[model samples]
Target: MEKIFYYFLIDVPRAMTIWAVLMVLAAAATVGLIMRPRHSGTGTADLAAEPGGPGPDGATPVGAEPALRAEEQRRRALASRALELHRYAEEVTVAAERSAVTAQRRRDEWLTAQEEAESAWQAYEAADVAARRVAAAAVLPEPRTPRTPAEYADRERYLHRAAMAACTRKELSVLQLSDALAHRNGWDPRRHPVEQEIVLRRTVRDSLFAAHRAATERERAAWRDAEVAAEAARSLREEAFAATAKAEEFRRWLPSSPSAGSTDGTAGGANGRVRPAVRWRAARAG
Candidate 1:
């Protein structure tokens, strides 16, 4: 009975040892199984929970996202500004072209006006020359000699009276009246009246009468009116001359411009400092 009891005790110790070894192996296996991922889902869940990992929320870091967005926005703004600048440049180019066209048109108009003014002046100069030539041709020759002393005396008396009357009118100067009368008779004073003794007396009487009449009878208003008419006629002539001159100047300066038309003063009229009626009569006589 003692041996049997001993054997049982030994078997019991071996069994307890085996049981402890099994328990240790089972605990290690339980820990490994609990820590292991079921599939890749648990790993993906863990990545999602962490920042800057493979999940959607973790793809970009929290601090870096704003910086990336700011960079993108800045690039877009730059592109927009570039487009606006290009459009502005095009507008400026168009405006410049329009300005150039307008300026050219204005220049063309100025050139045309200049040309017109030049042509009118040339016509006036030609007319003026012709009129002067006509006046020179109308002068009359002096009479040769008187038939008798009585005839000479009568002629001298008539000339003296006419000169005095002309002087009284104040239209002719002394020199002009003397020249007219001298030319009508003879230029020589010695042969003027055929009787030299009475010549001085007749001349003195005529001069006194002329002076008296001029001092009393001459009207200021009439003279002024005559002068105004003369001035108007002269102004017309001057204007024509100016137009001609301007045309010449234009030709000299800008040959490509337009031509000017004829002006009014080119034709002759009563332009002298004389009464209109007298001028008209004189013109007719010429």
Candidate 2:
């Protein structure tokens, strides 16, 4: 019985030593495997090459692990949205600046039109004064030389005729004189030059006034467009801020819940990560 006990004790130590050595070898192999470089056909490589799963480049590859892929997708989607909103804000800002410039230009044009209208009115007034003076000069009483000599009477008649004929100058064309004589819409036979001159001056004045009104209307429209563009740019900037804030939430790793049905509505990934199951739009309701 003593020899049997001694043999058992010796065998047990050797078996224990062998088991410990095997455990050490297993641990070393596990560490080596963990530190090894990956290539094709390896599990990690296969996961990276999976089709239709989101890669680090913001593309989804196929056959990727569902939970990890979903986490990546959530992060990428948030980042993409943030970048897109930032770019949109920039574009809107540029548009707002352009609209403001257009409004200023319209305002300048409106002012110029006002000046032109004033000048045109002045020209019309001057023309009207001259035409009235000529008309008045032609309306003198006929000379009475009945008791005078024949030469004196003829001279008096010639003087009256020349006064009436002086209103229409040689510069006036035959067609213009005929139109003035014919008494058209706004013409009068007694005031030939006044008829032609007043019509032309009034037409120019009316045209300038109309142009001023149109310029004013265009200025108002441009201002409205500028205001609208500024409002849009402001709103987009706020949205961009909100989007950036929301994207920042996904920058850190979110721990997964061990519960099968989490009350917080967080979805657990296979690698102890989680994604918010609910939409992140609660802050933008206003």
Candidate 3:
């Protein structure tokens, strides 16, 4: 019984050791078989087993060339798209610059025109003032009796005819009066007819002089009226042009931005003077 017990302890342990070793060997062999590269017509296992090496069939992996080509095409497409975007961006930037320059030039032209118009307006005003001064210096003539519109309409013709008649009649009357005065001076104290003829000729001459003075005054008044009317018309025309130019300047120079309205007066002129809209008053003046 003692020998049997000793044998069971030693031999059993030794046998168990040998079995464990064999099991380990079998597991290692199974792992090697499972992990080993298998030669195939497709050669997928060779490529999987050996990195950066030839396949078992000695040909490159299937579909690898197509994948590389596809990748190349993708890279080229990306590059092309990037180039197109760059060109588009550059074109947009150039266009924006050109637009800005055009807008600036337009603004300058408009501003110059406005200044010129303003100067013209001032000159017209000065002319009008001078005309008014001249008008005031002359006394406007009035007629002894108010004439009809038709008679006044042909006033120049009437004045010419009337002055001619007055001069001719006065010359005849003076010649007769000179003869009567010479004859009267010879025998005036004895005869009453000589004195009466002298008094009548003197009264006729005074009447002729009064008529001439009235016609001359009327002519001067007509000239003054014409000058005043002409000056007023010129002033109105200049004022209208100035207002219209100012309006056009604002429309052209203002920027196309959200803040453009606020920047109008501030950014418009050298002196920051804002141009007002063309009011109806300008049209009325015209």
Candidate of highest lDDT: 2
- Give all candidate RMSDs, comma-separated: 34.2, 18.5, 26.6
189 Cα displacement, candidate 3 (Å): 52
lDDT of 3 by residue, 4-91 (tens): 9999999999999999999999999999999999656555674656654556667655646676456445444443343344344444
The candidate, 2 or 3, that scores higher on lDDT is: 2
User: Per-residue lDDT tens digits of candidate 1, residues 97-189?
Assistant: 454455455555545544543433333343345444544544534357657877667766765665566466543457856775675432333
Which parts of model 3 have CA positions greater than 4 angstroms off?
1-59, 142-286
Q: Return the TM-score for each candidate structure.
A: 0.28, 0.36, 0.31
Task: Judge candidate 2 at residue 105 and give its lDDT.
Answer: 65
lDDT of 1: 0.47
In terms of TM-score, which candidate is stronger, 1 or 2?
2
Query: Better model by TM-score, 1 or 3?
Result: 3
Q: Which segments of candidate 1 are over 4 A away from where they belong?
A: 1-58, 137-286
Model 2, residue 95: C-alpha shift (Å): 1.9
Off by over 4 Å in 2: 1-66, 142-286
Better of 2 and 3 by TM-score: 2
